[model samples]
Target: MLSKYPGAVFRGALSGAARRAIPASFLSLRIALPLAMAFSLGLSLAVHQEACAQTDDEQTVKAIFDERLTSGEMYYLLEDLCKNIGPRLSGSEGAERAVTWAKEVMEGYGFDRVYLQEVMVPHWERGNPEQVRIVDVEGGMIALNALAIGGSVPTAPAGITAPVVVVHSIEEVEELGREAVEGKIVFYNRAFDQTVIGTGAGYGGAVTQRFAGPSQAAKFGAVGVVIRSVASNFDDAPHTGGLSYLEDVERIPAAALGFQSADRLVEVLEVQPDARLYMHLSSKWHPDALSHNVIGEIRGSERPDEIILVGGHLDSWDVAEGAHDDGAGTVHSIGVLRTFQKLGIRPRHTIRAVLFMNEENGLRGGLKYAEAAKESGEKHLIALESDAGGFSPRGFGASVDDDVLERFRSWLPLFPQNTISYVNKGGGGADIGPLRRETGTPTIGYIPDSQRAFDYHHAPTDVFETVNRRELELGGASIATLIYLIDKYGLRDEKAQ
Candidate 1:
């Protein structure tokens, strides 16, 4: 075996002066043997120490899982949030209640501190269930399952009936021009590409229609806008998300048709080219309302100034319990804190858990927190977010330097293969995006298997029971482990410094 010397200089080569001083016979195996033995001994000692450290880390991670699986409260916490609080859209009574509940729960856990940061959030209400139907159809008026996109302006009090025009994308809508789309209800029919391995990518690819379809339609003088649900599965449940109305154009009513409803509409439109849709949306927008981001933390024994953050959005859509959308993530953050306290694992860096508000309609809470964090002048080691649904752990997506990302990948052996197997590049959730941008701090997103996540996302079917107890607890455990590892070690890349 080759010896690794301190200055990266090997043993075989010798200076000309030294070579002459030492006898040629003495410079042979007789002298080389002792040096080789010394190097071997030193290497063995270093290997032994490294092995011991790894074993300790492995044991700690295993304990975290065991504690969560055997006696975790994440599931029950989720139940209370979903069943008791129901929906918690920003600026709603439910959101207020959730902020209070989150603060109290963390306080009850005996955290070092529990507090709230005020933020002004957008307030939009779906005053009544949307009414969307096809007029003069073969089977009379055919009602389609739909929900108003959050922040959408209401239609006329009596509603508007106009001929329907179908378009697959924003470019397509532009191609049709005003003449083809004027006084019509524009339908954006873009489906999720199931062939994509990451379901979130599919949702990402299709969600553009929902977010911008309204303004694009309004640009063409369309009376209203409808879009195929950006969902992975075909179902009657209609998903709802926020829409943006460009200031340059008029605001128009926008809603999402359930996957099944969109399919039915498409079939009917094929047979009856001049079909018209009557859409009535009573969704109202109020002035910005007061809200807060909930925070709790455990002070570090060492490095108290450097902070490590773990969080999820506290708000959800108004249509359902909002369990999988983010209720699962909320409990996961709390559960991590509870685990550390219960296990008596005092961290090296301050660990803070934040429940961000206004993730559904706006990111006021996230932006507020990032601004506050900057004002406070605290050093943030990293921020981790779990907004993906509670499912079996897949891995983490980290937005960090390439070298730091590789360093993270090196730690994967410490995790269970099934739970957390990879750490890919380029990911930090919406709520944590501002933090990464504001401070240049590394951000991580806890990724759970999302094959079924879109099934309940923003839909009424996203309730507490849809989450599995084992899967939810396991997710918490996985997050706790990652935080522990980062705290024990650190993010200071030696090469960068």
Candidate 2:
């Protein structure tokens, strides 16, 4: 059995003069600055770098990255998907069409196998356009731009016209008490902090309101909820994401305000006390509809029994082409698999690229994949999820045994040439989290330079136009390299190969 250690250590290797030695390409305007910053991050993990034999594995991975950077196919593939089949929200005709598109793609690329796993997903349609009318104290009604947040129930007949109660933080609502919250429209004005170099950090700070504000505010007898769009850009587009209601909490109408509208509303409220608003939404959840998880594979020659899975959700919010949010992720996952075949590199374990369904509104796709893995008693040696926006490769974050983690750390030296430094202990993407739990697999999430992801995340602007070509290919190469390494030398010695 492979030794699995619990103690964690980080080994960050860098010389004092690391800066000057890096080449001009390493000093890319798009990549170098982030790499230099990543270099300073002290990692105390210990690893036997000497033990990482200058093996064929290292050579193959380097070649993979080179190909990805120079001649990667993800660029053109994404063009067709985004320009052709844009905005594939799950259970919608677009999502269903995407499944067929993926199947044809796999076959056209000459994959050994291509298939789909049936997934029944919730279909929540955003009906007619939502209306937000600002009733001024001077008696003039101004219509504000808005959209119903995904998974939110539309307002009733004649809609809700209540005094808008704006709060900067959830704690502010608590401070104001139930007396102030009752029968009012709750507007969560928390914006994504842009100062953080890694925008994911900022998103981490403010996403709570978008995900849970409604149920929490409903507890205070709020009539409706309007969360500031979870975005870093200043625009008039309302972003949408998943929302859940706590058991027994009253379900009220919810929506998101564009950053500009949120700011304007704040300004108007300062001058005109007792600002009122009428919100009219017509969104609802219907019965489950058909969806599928698109699966394609490259069978191994040596140890076919072991499995390495790579994936991205095939669903997006129903606005712009879901390119960056996950369409880029899905294409990159497929791009990794396709690159292996194109490069003529056969693996030692079965490598699968799964395009998961319903990741936007529900986690049903992830849950089902894990459930099948558990019930079938199949061993998931390693699983990689690329739900993060397709940006330049930063490093890999993982949830694995300490010994396995130590082994992963040993491989960092190979990726330094590509400037991917961080390889820390972490969880996989939401779509693969359940699989990690059910199978106890060594799960990994692709970490790109999260510098610009939040600006477009879950928003209409999260389209192909926002996706950087070089960055997308870089991300694909990183994932392909990780997949190659894990598949070749198995994640653990104890796993049957």
Candidate 3:
């Protein structure tokens, strides 16, 4: 069990000096001249003191990086987690092992406290291989690479055999109405927008179809849905992600086709407008199963009641080893705590690392954590999440008010020349988002390079070997440095004015 208390407010230290009323009367020529010179000297001393303090902060940041680069354990820990535990889908045996392993590792690191918070999560298994084939095409049957979307309902024993209706957007499905879409398998061919500079932007632009297409098509009496993989790379690797079913509508089977497969589908449809598809999916959802959010903490020297959270989801999609999807992020969170202990940096606020469960298909872990925080009245100053893949560090994305954004921007110079140089406006992470929405706590997301993330995202190719050691360690150090700054200065809203 965990104990929670009321939120704590921090007050800034005040200067003891008071102004005297005799200043105006002492304006005589001789007296005023020496007074002015003394005041100028005092101003010079103050400026010098400020400069010295900045140098000390810079030195501390440098030390954090030095410790991370030379003797970092994140990469090794990641290797063990990936090779040993493998895929940790929530409620599965792998997920249970991961929970135990994470807690044990934190305790071994000698954190002040280590514990687990109970969470009930959805358990969905991708049972057997899926099948998708073009039945009535001109050149006969053609098999397409595919993976069932998480939480999708399984097709009947005979499977679904229906004519295909192609639509680019959900709006098109609506415009077609039930007459054209009924009893047909809707094919969503919206590809990733390559023109977007940020690959993440391209993903955001195209992912809506994968997440909402199934239910939207079901609304129009569609039998099944197949969406182009929400990926940038033009390859045969099919990307899988979670999808939600509308409670009021019928749940239909949904799957993603790789870029090449999607292109082939278009070619057939152009030649034979009456082409039909045969889809078989064995994915199913089980009853809610017990899980836990693995938590570890280093108590603050002064404000132990105040908390600064660093974390990533421990559970990932079951397809691959989840190395880049979140294995790197899990180790990155642990590395932040390890850095604090190794460097002997006792922060002013408690630093807690949370390995959230069930972020891939369901957000049960995140929802539970936020609920407990609300009920217990815990005061969280900020929550930082590293869900983005472990690529070269770009910067951070912050979900905070304008004033807080400016304050974070002021510390941009503390980072290395090209690594983590900016803080843009965005949601921190799926697990931490509820905490931000419930409380006013500021949230931050570590934004690594997005160019190659989709190539390995939720595919079989995402393995431990793909992650770079230096890049992973750098991400950890970046997170630690940001945490150090937050712990020292506090957030703009919480700090003394």
Candidate 4:
């Protein structure tokens, strides 16, 4: 069949070879004429095949974007997940409901398979609202906005009241020694670095205080710990994230004060330097609960054994609806599969969508998934995660070699201008990290605009209303396009170890 289009095929071969120009005058006429014709015939067939594949991929990607923009269902699904299911903290009724809803939705979509992978997840509850007050100062008692850190031990019914000792980092606490920190409440007032252009970078710089401050302060006999919220914006709303406790050290209650409240604490300290604080946190940890990693897949027609996975965590902090932290990612995963089915695009490699559980506090779901894959000998060719937020698409970050990265960068021009045009080397996400480490699966993280993500991260402001429909849909489309590309032309030299 290809022999009929000899001219077109020869042109395709010449186009590919043009990248590394070969001289035509090197060959003598008698040998060159016949040999060149034979070589062209063979090369032309291969070239034609390659060009056909590229054309199909281009058209498919365009169709994915069009379908997502015109009839995308992720926005409405997110509305239900956020408004109806609400916050899906691990072990909460909300989480159970979300699991059921996700399973049912995937089944309704008629995926080839839909199931759950059982996992034991930590269960932490915010028993009651937290209380923090600045006292023993010239201004009398002043209340400060606060929220208890996840996985923190509950304070006594009456709570603890002690003199406040402020410090910037854990190093400063060690320098102060036990004499100054003992029997006092340690206040970590390190603010997010404003100079960092990426809000995630700024969050990383200041998040240690929230995650490890309590246990570090406890080493010096501190009764409690209060950290300034790890947020970019200066607002009265406190951001709450998970805290870790050292087994060797005493577990003490910890909470995050809102940006404005931290500022007030600093002001009071400057004037009196002997301020006392009374803090009450009712957060508690229950026994580990059984959860499941919700999974759905569209089996590939050609290479069913090889898998491509995309996912996000289903759990969120208990404070808000979790519309962005991961609610966007959850629906985004589903949207990818939905778009494939809607476009009737049968993939070459099985595409699986996993909604991980307990990513906010524990990585049990991710760990369990990796373990199950290893035990079952399931092969994952590539994994991608979308946990950044439902914001404008900004390409993907990959934990791949230089050659693979270059191949991905070459496709940047295929994407729409100003949408998903960048590719960088980095870890994919918390949920996919284990898979990469355990199986050497190439991982990709969907990168989105980060300027506004931290504003509502782990706070009550991360609600359904904060997400934009266009931005969220665009993200879904971008993910689908990437998945389509991978399905068409699998990542460079991917092999399951």
Candidate 5:
């Protein structure tokens, strides 16, 4: 390393002494100069080593983050993804295009290894436009804007047109009992509570009704299930999300009515005492289709056997552009890996980027991924998932033992300038959950403060325009810094104090 400094002293060395080699004094000068040079070199090396031992290079790691963030590729790439691919529902042609595009983009980035892991995924097709109409004694019929919830079957050629029964929650249906609910449209009337400071809290309170309400109503012998729009603000758009059916109970058609339609249904139900509804859905489930989990890796230098995992689900619900739900997440994950590559800051463990499939309806992608890792005898050091929207990052939530949690907590104070203080023990992510339960590898979730997420969470308003470019970049830097620390310092083996 010191060879480069020889040029600075070369001219002075050439100028020293009048004659090139005066016999007696020249020979003595040569021997003394070489000895002095070796001794000075040894002393200089000791001082440099001590300085390095005293100073931490955390600031340098953070500098890489700052520089890359100032000029990151995530926002621009996300723009093209949303503009071209639009919506990438699991089985749709759009999703296939996204797979190709993702593969090409990563290869374009010049990854050392770029490949796809094949995984079979459920293929539920949302057919042509669905129509829903409310019948009034005077008005006769009023068509409403609505969409069939994912995984719904077609309601015959004539369609399912039944009397609408508006219920506040699954509890209401339980109270109404099978007698009242049989052969009627069960409408879940729970609304997202906008008053909550953390809008994610409001979404958490309401999403359970969307996921489980369908099966719960099926238990009571209902013909179909309809939940009120899952949005904080009023709109005509019907938000669609995942719904699961119980094993023994019959599977009924389910849909989400727009906020306005839900309100009118209540009013019409009051006047007529019995208002009928006509809903026609055209949907079907094809056989499982082939999908891929795109994986990229950066090999470690020393402890290469240990692995650090980071990912975002590639499949999104087929409505809007699927921007905030996961497009933001997908791009953010890619950005984390790209940041390291651009800075030439190589991780000490194998760093992986896994774009999971079928996360919206089924966790088949995550399940298959964990199984493959276990089968291959790969020891996952830690897994981090980012599915929550790319709002400003708050901190990480871990599904770790107490000691591991403490180690993460110790780093929280380091993030004060970024206002990230909330590292704690919690569920990692839906996709990463199975890995934690099965592999015992620690998992972490990227959590942004939950304000305004529920407003556009699953609604059509969740377009690419909703993503804040600055906030997204900040989030990418935050995760990258965490990865740097974890890779440099191994995780705690026991519970946190």
Candidate 6:
């Protein structure tokens, strides 16, 4: 399937009348004066043309925004992914269905090419509902809403019951030593730092306890680990995310308690001094299974060999629909291609959209794509990712050299002041990080408003209803406009010339 190619450029012609031959003495003076005037006139015309091009860029950006805001299709696409297919953890039936669905949807849009790249992905399942409770509280027994961390080992059939030892950080567990932690449950009670302006920074600051706490506690001979939910709001829903276990340390079960439940546990521990808790998880690890990264593109009219990639992970946690975590990003990437094709805006560089698999539990898809690019000797112009929730646009965070960053900053005027106002340094997506490292492709992370991102990140509440249609469309429009600019004007340092 292909859209009619619109590969035409219009040029303005300037013609002048020829003059009769002159005498040798007068020829030198007449020729010099005309030549000097011609040079000045040429410079003025060049400046005027540059200004006209800049104005066209602004008008084009506005058109893209208008189309997306008024007649966007990403919202419906996200609905199908989040509602019909639901959670798509790698190696599961849902993940496979998502692969096929994405392929067909892109094909329907009539991209020039559509295909899949095979990748073996890690497979793990949350087998059953987790059972965690504060057994020794004054009230009969308080059940704490919790979820087993992805990639964690299952607890004993009968479950674990022991005295709870509270620690704010992994270092605190080290301070307590094996003597205090052995045969006990380590509760990592650190909460999100509300003082941080960016919620993402707060998540980064607190996520270490969830990602490394289990292994660190296990190193000190703890039987189990429990952590406060890495969430922005105080609610009954528990957030689930992947955990990394060191090879040398003993594998132990880990879970995250809802913010309110965590606070309840703290209150009990404060009064009782030595409160016992019970935790039972039914999570299991399966053999790595086959998956694929769905890819589609509208080949560049001029520079087909050089590619500009836009992508997001397709696999989400199995807890609930992954609307914000990445469903927004997946649709955003596809929307870029759809908008370009619908408007007949053939890019100058091959613009490819990738729906990477296995970002939730593992980065297999991203690594595979990068490896393939290197083997084929592919040249990537840039890679952009949208993993943040589908919120109103803010700007982008870039992982590029200062010259490239400056070049990107110059294009900010094309975008509206309310949308995409800044382009900061130091940001890239988990899936695209390998590509940047393997191929040296400059990376950009689409930054939406961070206020409500953590609220649904990795939680059951991250469903389709939480996403606002206008917000999601605006995010996609912002990405499309950026890609259009990058394709139109290459990322070279023009000032050097």
| TM-score for each model | 0.91, 0.86, 0.91, 0.91, 0.86, 0.91
The top-ranked prediction according to lDDT is 6
Residue clash pairs of candidate 6: none
* Greater-TM-score candidate between 2 and 3: 3
- Runs of candidate 3 with Cα error greater than 4 angstroms are 1-48, 137-139, 493-497
Off by over 4 Å in 2: 1-58, 416-418, 493-497
- Identify the superior model by TM-score, candidate 2 or candidate 4: 4
Poorly placed runs, candidate 4 (over 4 Å): 1-12, 15-55, 493-497
Candidate 4 local Cα displacement, residue 235, angstroms: 1.2
Model 1 local distance difference test score = 0.88
Off by over 4 Å in 5: 1-58, 493-497
* Model 5, TM vs. native: 0.86
Give RMSD to native, each candidate. Answer: 4.5, 11.6, 5.2, 4.4, 9.9, 5.4
lDDT of 2 by residue, 128-188 (tens): 8889878899778877767787888889978988998888777787888899999999999
Comparing 1 and 6 on lDDT, the stronger one: 6
For residues 1-497, write the lDDT of model 3, one tens digit per residue.
00000011111111112124236888799788887776666555654555555666788889888887888588889888888999889989999999999999999999999999999999998888999999875547899999998889999977888999999998999999999999999999998898987888888888888899999999999999999999889889899999888889999999999899999999989989899999999887789999999999999998999999999999978888899889988988988889989988998899999999999988888888998998889999899999888888989999888877877788888798878888998659999988887776779999998888988888877889999988988888899999998888777535353
* Candidate 3: count of backbone clashes, pairs at least 3 residues apart or interchain: 0
| Cα lDDT, model 3, residue 93 | 92
lDDT, candidate 5, equals 0.78
- Model 5 weakest lDDT span, ten residues long: 1-10
Candidate order (lDDT): 6, 4, 1, 3, 2, 5
lDDT of each: 0.88, 0.80, 0.87, 0.88, 0.78, 0.89
Predicted candidate 1 versus true structure: per-residue lDDT over 314-338, tens digit per residue? 9999998989889988999988889
Find the 10 residues in a row with the least total lDDT in model 4: 1-10
lDDT of 4 by residue, 1-497 (tens): 23222222345555666424446665687777776776677677777776675566668878888888787589889999999999999999999999999999999999999999899999999998899999866648999999998898988899888899999998899999999999999999999998998888999989999998999999999999999999989888999999999999999999999999999989988988888998898887789999899999999998999999999999999998999989999999999889999999899999999999999999999999998888888999889999999999987998888876876777776688878978988859999999888888889999999989999999999998999998999999999988887777566534422
| Clashing pairs counted in every model | 0, 6, 0, 0, 4, 0
